[model samples]
Target chain A: MYQTISENQRHEFIAKLQPVLPEIQYYLPSFLDRRILFVMNKMGFADWQNFMSYLDNDHSYDAIFSFLMVPVTEFFRDSLVWHTLFHTIVPKLIKNDPCHVWFPDCSSGHEVYSLCMLLDILNVRNRVRIYAGCKSQQTIDKIQTGVYSAQCESMLVANYKNAEIPYDISKYYTINYNSLICNPELLSNVSFIHSSSLLEDEVPQISLIMYRNSLLYYTTDSQHTFITTMYKKMNFGAYLLLGIKEGGNIFGLQALFSTYNKDLGLYRKK
Target chain B: MEIATTYKLIVIGGSAGSFASVNHILQELPARFPIPIVICMHRLKHVNSGFKETLEIVSKNKVVEPFHNDLLEPGHIYIVPANYHMMIQSDMRVLFSTEELVNFTRPSIDVLFYSVAQSFGKNAIGIILSGAHKDGVDGLHDMYKIGATTVVQDPQEAQVPTMPQAVLDVMKPHYIFTLRSMIAFLKAHI
Candidate 1:
């Protein structure tokens, strides 16, 4: 029989894991003993002996929690989201020349690319400056590389189709066998930052902020906290896009933004 | 006949805290590391896609949303698309299912781990990261059953202990380490 963690032990575990709260809240309910046992076996703990030995040694749970927060992104993900941005949002923002847009979890510059592509299609490339952020230096380097693979090309093609943006997709990439490197010019007007959400102090005022699908991992409380902070940073009438499932109700902070979009559920400050 | 030389495959599954965890592991890994990584993250049923780019930027690994029948390759990270369950085939091809969501997740970790264990056997490495539910517990056990190496992020280090701790309670992983050490282990082994 699998040994179950006592409520006390579970409490201790939760206390240890608190640094990653809110994001972990979504997964806390279903972690019964059987499930823990199953995870132990899957990780090759091999019965009780190995498990006890691991517990006895020095272990850093924060490192493990970091291992769990794998935020993977692609260029121009969710064609509809980009479509809405290009057709509806960008047009409104472009009226204000030299508009600044912020992407908090820019990750590898795909969202940057999406934004650039939108600006290019709208013929507003010279009228915008983008501030994109990622927590990893390595990703910042990749964003500097301005290269991508053919696998990325497929999605870019789809995004182009959905947004009805006109450009030869092949022209933006230089093919090397199966891989496709994005043209350097596509990234000329972007700025990259290596920062974490917890550490950011101040942000430039901007007309639009796209934080797509990045905040769902946080706990609802943290989500509210971050949203509150973001609300402070955003300009009046600034637009914010959260993950589809995220950002419907701001609890007591209902005056910040009004929710819109049936398929995408985007929020904009009133 | 001797098998052709190829990179070992590592598949990691998790829900919460996955972004930070994957980034930590990938950051510790050198650019020359010779292994492919497949990730299955729990996402909303109708969510907008951007996760692949997010992971790619954070990890600096080549990340893509896995397409139906896409050939699995080394040096690239494939993410199971949202609203679909991703699985691996005997020949290392990617597969997807639009079947009803299990545990309310389309890109389930268990489904991916089980398929990879079946396909690669001992060559496969299965990891269960931080999450709220028991989604990957069964699949990690399946990996152990198939003689593949299995790992869970030490619950002490997990953003959500329920997911990794749940595995620790049931599964006896060969190794349990923080994301840094896990990346070091994978780098050395790969």
Candidate 2:
């Protein structure tokens, strides 16, 4: 459908979205181009003008934003990084005062739950406080439900095995109606926030921040803004983990943080 | 055959016994090569250390694993990090997806080739090299359909022939050269 649109019409369509969801400016044109197709299809519109007409309708903004912000994450998505976090980083953080961990973009709470499992195995679950942040209230509500699709069970098991977890992963969940409900007791200390790192508002200081693959979705300038702001919200000697492919040197981040383990995308606040 | 005057990107895909051949190709390129190159080599998920630094030691061009959101730049070789499928977004920045595997491989050759076909179209150049199985044939076909220059390693000389043979069986690539001749072909055309 995008191929049929004129180049000028495409830009005009993007310009229409710029004000309502100001964050679109932070994404690359190609990424947005692909996503806009998904957006148009979800909104039940075939043409740009139809999309525009619906946007002008009453109470459409929230539904559009929710569609654009669907969470895409899996349990132990990057197993090797989780391995290092469990064996090295988590132990180091626990040695300090009761660890305060944060997941700035907790897209569906996979990362948060992964950390919970690690802390549980280490027998330090009582000594931690987790702050999981999301871009939308709808996602926050979904995370609170603690349900994951049954189709992902095999992949989740494979990831745990890859991470070398010694115990059976099934102990953590109860299967019901094609979904896995994570044990409610394990989530007792977690708090969900409807926030973005780019926001300048005050947030709690954290000891370890897991801001992974989501950074690639942002524009470079937005990346610089969010990373620097996130740096200020972290406590002294905190550790920051990014996606294995997320190189941090572009924004003078090297000057602010020392390379903890380049392969794992771990950085230590200097 | 007509040759394009220039290209926006060059993508190379290989697996199995391709490391030495790719290393030789990288060693042959000039320090400030005019176009950016992306290489996708199938690797074990557990083996994730020093592939970038090791390549940097021998190549004239800078070798680095592109971070997410990293913009494409000339004179550098972007190594696709293992365990993830990489796609080039319309903005020409790197987008990594942890979606289910394709062709039984993450960082699948076809995934990168399809994205390059979408982003660069006729302005892209795609090369398929030595591999154990038919991983890159579909990608080369996608590049061919989009009017991009498609090349493959000569199966006769490849350490493993299944990959190049599959492409030869499906469609005629623009060039099928051995490692030594491939470097010369690139210098002459690129």
Candidate 3:
């Protein structure tokens, strides 16, 4: 449904895009290129010039942000990571006090919802406060509606099974009109944050931040900035969950935080 | 036979019966193979760790499952992790995406091959090994047309010839190498 920018033309696009979308300046060029092409093609933009002209003329990008960011990707993507989080990390995070969880890049909310089901199963749903970060209200509304294609049901069930969920996943959602409607109670302990970015947001006292598959897109400088920012905001005993690929000390921020589980990308704030 | 063209990255795409051939190629390579070899093979997504571990045991070079923005380094064999589409950047960094599936697979060889062709152009080497799908054909075509060196495993010897046959049907690759000849070619070039 969309056209992609050629690799030859990437440098030019990055040059044009940085001044406008400063936040994405540090994103890995390949990933940003895909997202840019997706937005331009989906928005009927003939080329980068046309896309830029529209952005210049419109002076608004709420729609662009909606189109650019991906939503509701793999649920419990790496089941081992999810298993580690529930079994190992969460217990330490919620040692005594109620835990405040953050999802700084909560695109479309499937991951957060997966956590909601997990938290509910743990019966500590009442003790955790989840902050689902959103760039626009469209995402909030979409997540609140909690409707997904029935086609994806098999994968969800499969991931749930792989994660070794004790309860049947079917109880959490009902299929209607070829859509899976998540139970409304899933959002009981969740709070939506419009502040958008963890880098800029001073939202404090987070016990855990589920920032998986996200840091890989960031440039080294931005990754350092993020680690530094989280170091300040996260409580000393809090935890951070990155993507599984972020294993083996790739982030190299050990001075600030200790590696709780290197393979699963779970860390503890020192 | 010596390959005349200088290359920066070598990306190998395989599936089904290519595992043994891939193992052969990696096992034969010396410790300091300068060009980074990126292997994108279709494996069971739920079955992740074992494949990497098995490859590690056989290969001389260090096998790595790369994250997004992992800088391409010499002497390391980058194996595309299961369940994610892996791509290469012009800056020699590996990238990952969970966006969607292509050709009924997540770590689609086409995605990685096409991305490398676009980013590395003629400097990259594209190799198609034995498999049962047509995933790498279009991607190999892209790399071939872009002036990158394209090699297809000998279809006659391929355990599952569908993938190699599919590539042969589209465009004749620069070199059609058997398992031994491919290792020799790689060792000679490096």
Candidate 4:
């Protein structure tokens, strides 16, 4: 059997990487304990020492950060969330004007497309603008391409069916060489940003922010900062959608948002 | 008698024909056991409504369907919630992913076992109970390689032998305890 890294080695690896990529400082300590070596091997380095040696300049930071990004997302994930958006939230927002929506931590564009699919169904496609953000530039570029490998088609279709969408899932996309290219028209007003929402201080005021399923990756302090910053940057009466697990009232932010749907983790700003 | 004093986490995975064994394990496990136990089973996403309730009825410890980013605390049996792959992030928080199904199962046995191996290393213990396929075998091997304690039900005694037999075929586990023997061993050790 192979030997795993000792506690001392794990600490040493974190100590070495923290200076070059300070963003990892906000990750859960246990996350580093499990993933530090997995990430090292992922970057084509044999061990911690080799990874440290490769960190020769400022340019190495991007490569290191890319290795940490988990691009594991599916289209129309959590069918209920999409159902709620299409049925309840989107209708409320679009009643005022064309709503500007933001999907921070867009995670390879699944959420953006899911929302676009809903907008298209509601005949509000021309009325909405989506700003999709992620920490990985490569993911942003991939999102811009609007083509997903067909491996996810079954799951996407299943989710759509679960959400009880009126049209067949195939109506939305054309299949090419095992890739599902989203209809170009759906992506017209979508902008992809290679940025972290936690770090972006000046994003456009949004009416709906879909920040689902990514908060646990950050430390508690970062989570707090993200909550308040998002609250400040959103328009009055804006809605915030978080991971279902994150629905509990955040400390000190109860006065700002009223719970819209606790099960679906939707909050509306006062 | 000192088994409970060792590992920080214990992960158990099962699939078809597993409920009986899981119930037995939970009933035998101590409420005050000082390690967190995470149980992952392959169940249809939409039909898992009663799973936590079922486990809590037998479990002496608190049985929880944990939220994303929920901290791992001792004296609780954490059940893998529906429609997500439960991963132990390097930050020690329990994270759920809507990632593609592995081994045709979300809350994949391989995913959970490998994560516990990575997070706890020698401080982890993984046990594979009755299951239909080979989902947990690779993960058990990963745990074994990391010096974590690995165990499998005696395939001969399992309701479905394919899963445990797969583990036995790969890495030699620390113990291959049947339901009765496993309970006896824990009583003796814990």
TM-score of candidate 2 relative to the true fold? 0.77
The weakest ten consecutive residues by lDDT in model 3 chain B span B45-54
Which stretches in model 4 have alpha-carbon errors above 4 Å?
A: A1-22, A32-43, A47-67, A249-256, B1-9, B27-36, B46-50, B56-62, B71-76, B83-106, B110-125, B133-135, B138-150, B187-189
TM-score of each predicted structure versus truth: 0.51, 0.77, 0.89, 0.82
Q: lDDT by residue for model 1 over A110-159, one digit each (tens)?
A: 67876786788778887888887765566677767876666767666765
User: Per-model TM-score of chain A alone?
Assistant: 0.73, 0.88, 0.88, 0.87
What candidate 3 gets wrong by more than 4 Å, as runs, is A1-22, A47-50, A53-60, A248-252, B30-34, B68-71, B89-92
Interface DockQ per candidate:
0.02, 0.30, 0.39, 0.32
lDDT of model 4 at residue B51?
74
Which candidate, 2 or 4, has the higher lDDT? 2
Q: How does the DockQ of candidate 2 come out?
A: 0.30
True contacts kept of each: 0.00, 0.34, 0.28, 0.28
| Clash counts for all predictions | 62, 4, 0, 10
The CAPRI category of model 1 is incorrect
Q: Of the candidates shown, which would achieve the greatest lDDT relative to the real structure?
A: 3
- The list of candidate 2 runs beyond 4 A from truth reads A1-20, A41-45, A58-67, A70-72, A96-98, A175-177, A196-202, B2-4, B7-9, B14-36, B41-64, B69-77, B85-111, B114-123, B129-147, B152-184
Q: Write the per-residue lDDT of candidate 1 for residues B15-60, one digit (tens) a residue.
A: 8877788777766666645778888888753345566666677665
- Per-residue lDDT tens digits for candidate 3, residues B1-190, read 3457888999999999998898888888999789899999998876554877888998888999886667889999999988778888888877777765789898999999889888988898899999999998888899988889999999999999999999999898999989898888878776
- Residues A1-270, candidate 4, lDDT per residue (tens digit)? 323577687666656666654556676565555466667776777766666667654443556555566554578877888888888888888887757888777667777888888888899988888887767676676777889988878778878888877776677788899998887667887877765445663468889998876665666787777788788878998999887766563443466788888778788889
Q: C-alpha displacement of A83 in model 2, angstroms?
A: 2.4
Candidate 4 lDDT score at position B47: 43
lDDT of 4 by residue, B1-190 (tens): 2344366778999987788898888888878777788999888764435878888899999998887767888888998877678877545678766544678887798988888887788788789999898998999899989888788899889999889988988878989998988777655654
